[model samples]
Target: MKSLTFLLVFVPLLSVCRSQSETGVDEELGDEEHVELFTTATTKLAAATSDFGYNLYRALASQDASSNVLLAPLSVSTVLTQLSMGASETAERQLYRALRYHTLQDPQLHNTLRDLLTSTGTTGKGLSTAARVYLSRRLRVKPEFLRLVEQQFGTAPKQLMGGAKDLKDINDWVSQGTGGKVQRFLTKPFPRNTGVNTVSAAHFKGKWENGFSQSNSLESFQIDGGTTVRVPMMHQDNYPVKMGVDSDLSCTIAQIQMQDSVSIFVFLPNDVSANLTTLEESLTAEFVQDLSMTLLPAEVSLMLPVLSFSSTNELQPLLADLGLSDWLTSPGLEKITAQPVKLGTVNHKVVMEMVAEGNRYASSTSPPSHLALRVDKPFLFLVRDESSGALLLVGRMVNPKNLRI
Candidate 1:
């Protein structure tokens, strides 16, 4: 199938830190030793986050199957894990259960997070992730918490004055963190007496391993059951990529390789009669792992619609819907501060693009026999960090014409 280039971004609200009293500093590992540590910790983290991501997506899809949806489960979990570090007993229980952290106990969770973020930001990679907590200047955050955050997350809490200028500064900080892909992340004014605001951001931009044909053309796109719109479709003939089918879900799975160490997997239903719910519910870290192991490479002609969109969701309601309800109350954050502290307007924003950029198309060769795959209808896709097998960005495209840029 044709190679697709996509840029995916996710912004999630959450905060966290390490603990000096609860846990001692972990010994540093050498390159070889760290690789093993990362592999173990990341695998456990991936399982928890993947379960949470699929669960969250299921909740979103239930409300509006025809609307475009995007999110970064890793982003949310990473920030929440940090929040859990300082959470009171009640709040910590809820957060840990929601993240499925109970399944695996990685003593070096904080150190592993540090390594993961550092590894993903190496030069030439198209992915980056960041998390930080903004505390009110009036509050006295624990010194132990501050030290751990600085040592583990690599960023210290910034004092928020709770003014328009401070909001502008936070937005600007997010924009710069994501390479200007996301701006105005916080549009609403900071609430009075806001004690803590957690923020997480992730961005990825990658080119196709085999560049798509630059000759883009207009084609019919099925936004939903009753709507049809024309959209720019990029095409490539005899593209080599891994392909598979999950008959139980009645969908075709294709893994498109990126120039960097990443892959985008698209799940397009076999036809209009196919069930999207079945496919979505079946997604898990283990399923993806199996697919990657079994996917066979083959030459195929592909047609995919271009998409650029952004979506924002209020995370409080969604988190509640997912059984993380206690965070909306006074006792939810007793451990965070002596003063009563409750969550306020936890928001998530996602920006994505599938434009062809800096592609170097190889000289055309004699055409070979190939299968044809055309994505003309609503579908679910995810951009994954190949090395860690973590889902960087997962989204559904219902209407290619509904451009949110």
Candidate 2:
């Protein structure tokens, strides 16, 4: 897609468990004194998060192969990492393993996360991430936990009295974070005994270095073997694009240029007869990096269907399947406070819009040729931040006619 916009909303289901007794105290900030930036550990964490994201993608895609699936991999991973800061020994272990950061120590893992977030902002992309923990006024939250939240995640824990107005406040925060792309993330009223609530959101709209024209025309898109739909496909000819084929997955990969040190890579299968399962299963951070190296630049004619869709996914079941089970049931978060608590719900929602932009190149550099790459069927695409090598968004367009935007 030419212009891609993504919004990710992550809200942990926070309900209290008053029956259990827990006793613990805050550990001193001993890790901070010894914390140092570990580049190798950071690189490993990036690769691990990508692997975890792909695994989660396959699980989500298996639910409905014909339906579209869009996700912000970095956003979800960062949220889980933040939650780990207050987790006890066993719970933190499961979280680290699930996030693919089991090999990293506490200090190294957090420092790398801080650096990664910083690098993305400096790259000039329209990317933003915000996280907050909302606690009930009745509970006495530990000062150390609040301090770590501010020092590491850059946000303080906010106290909520619990009502419709408090829900509106949280939604307002989400709306402001996503630039109004997500107006109301929390759709239901808060439970009467709701003790803790955590929200994480990310928004991204990348700039194109060589832009596309605003003009668009209706084109035929193959939804499946016996289905065809007409969508407003955007066109740009004589643009230099890197194209290649992945024989293992029976798909062609095309790297499209964008401004602000990033690019959108498209995975179009050879034909509609092929499904995205094979390609989705084969995805990994290393595989994508290697595939990027194999692309050969060529003057190409492109036809990409305009895709804009919003989706919401509940992640509690998926998190359990990924081995982070404690947070859902018997969460041992003694560091946050002495109160016995468990995560209530972990819901993720997104609102995305992809639109045409300026026509920077007035004329084509090469003559119109017979060769072209038209994405007319089910295909997958990803927006990657080149500066820090982070995958910003992953999406699959199965039926272009059913755009939710």
Candidate 3:
């Protein structure tokens, strides 16, 4: 179980049309003062990294049950908790029970995952995540496990000066930690007693506090109740999202709103040949933070679908069939190098971009009234951090002509 190669690239820029008279009431009291600045240990590490990102997206969607899935489960759970700071106690108890975090305790689980990766790398928050640890320049690490993985993931550990400039310096540090949207993340090379290697990258490009209404009239989409496809749809009328339904996962949840606080929920699945396996086994993290606090705000009439795609996955036999077989068979990192190492080849990559721009303050001829919410077909999306609810990316989108361009 040492295969691990997960990659995802999605492009879906713009589309979120805000209006309820431009969200006033001091923006709902600034979202209740941004949920009182989160911190019951960063809300239990964002509900244990979103319940380990919905159990790693239901073990990678039960192995291709119709393809299309994405990941960044908080950058693969922060590179397995920074390689469990040089794991040992049976691979740090199988990486804290496969990252549900074994009921988080020790040092409040690395200071609440370094304050949830410094509030999801703040600065304009289009979302960003990075993790690294590549040794093997003739091993000999353990300087207190590189000072506890550079004091809880601020980065540190770069030795590998082997072949081809260590694959172009690990693909130029994953294209500058994904700001370049994950270019050439080691297309090939590095697999010959590769002592140790762990890299994680996540990049998101959704910035729509309000915008949408681009239509070249393609529509059609329903890839299920007897296949169809036309794509290129993004529109809005009243738009001011946050809707709900759920009848126990029958689906149809919305939530949209992106810009600094970041939130995109979308579930869909009413039944276009429904089979999202009970909405992907009814996701967790306290049921998606109580369905994002009981979604309500309305004024809909939206239609989405301009999504772009890219996915390349291996995921170490789906994380050793999800029980994490001793973290890929016998991983006692030996404090990251005592002439003995185990876990190797775990490269993860993700990139996203979503599209439709045009809300310089609404009035793009706002006419159509209430309830419409059309998202054509197969769906499931999540990309939160609504001030610390954290699950940074998780997707499904079944098909949009599988756009990899």
Q: Put down candidate 3 lDDT per residue, 1-405, tens digits, no spaces.
A: 011111111123222323232446556655423233234777777878888878878988887778778887888788778888787787787778878778766566787788778878876767676778787777777788888788767788777877888888888877787676777777776676778777787777777788875554688888875878888887878778777665546677888887887878888887888898677777776666666665667677788887655455546566775588766777778887777666667777777777765345377466676458889888988888777788888888878775763
Q: Whole-model Cα lDDT per candidate?
A: 0.70, 0.70, 0.73
Q: After superposition, how far is residue 125 of candidate 1 from its true place, in Å?
A: 3.7
Q: Worst ten-residue run, lDDT, model 2?
A: 1-10
Model 1 lDDT per residue over 41-72, tens place: 87667666777877787787778876788886
What is candidate 2's lDDT per residue for 1-405, written digit by digit as tens?
Answer: 011111111123222211111211113322223322225665666667777777777778788888888877777787667667778998788777888777655466787877877776553576665556677777777888878868886777777767788879888987787777766678775566666666666666666666666335888898786788989887778766777665546677888877777778999998896878877877777667655555667656778887666777766577776766655687677787799876655656666655566338667555674558898888998877765567777878888786773
Candidate 2 local accuracy as lDDT? 0.70
lDDT accuracy of residue 112 in candidate 3: 72
Instruction: State the weakest 10-residue window (summed lDDT) of model 1.
Output: 1-10
lDDT score for residue 138 of model 2 = 76
CA lDDT of 308 in candidate 2?
Answer: 64
Superior candidate under TM-score, 1 versus 3: 1
TM-score of 1: 0.84
Better of 2 and 3 by lDDT: 3
Report the C-alpha displacement of residue 207, candidate 3, in angstroms. 13
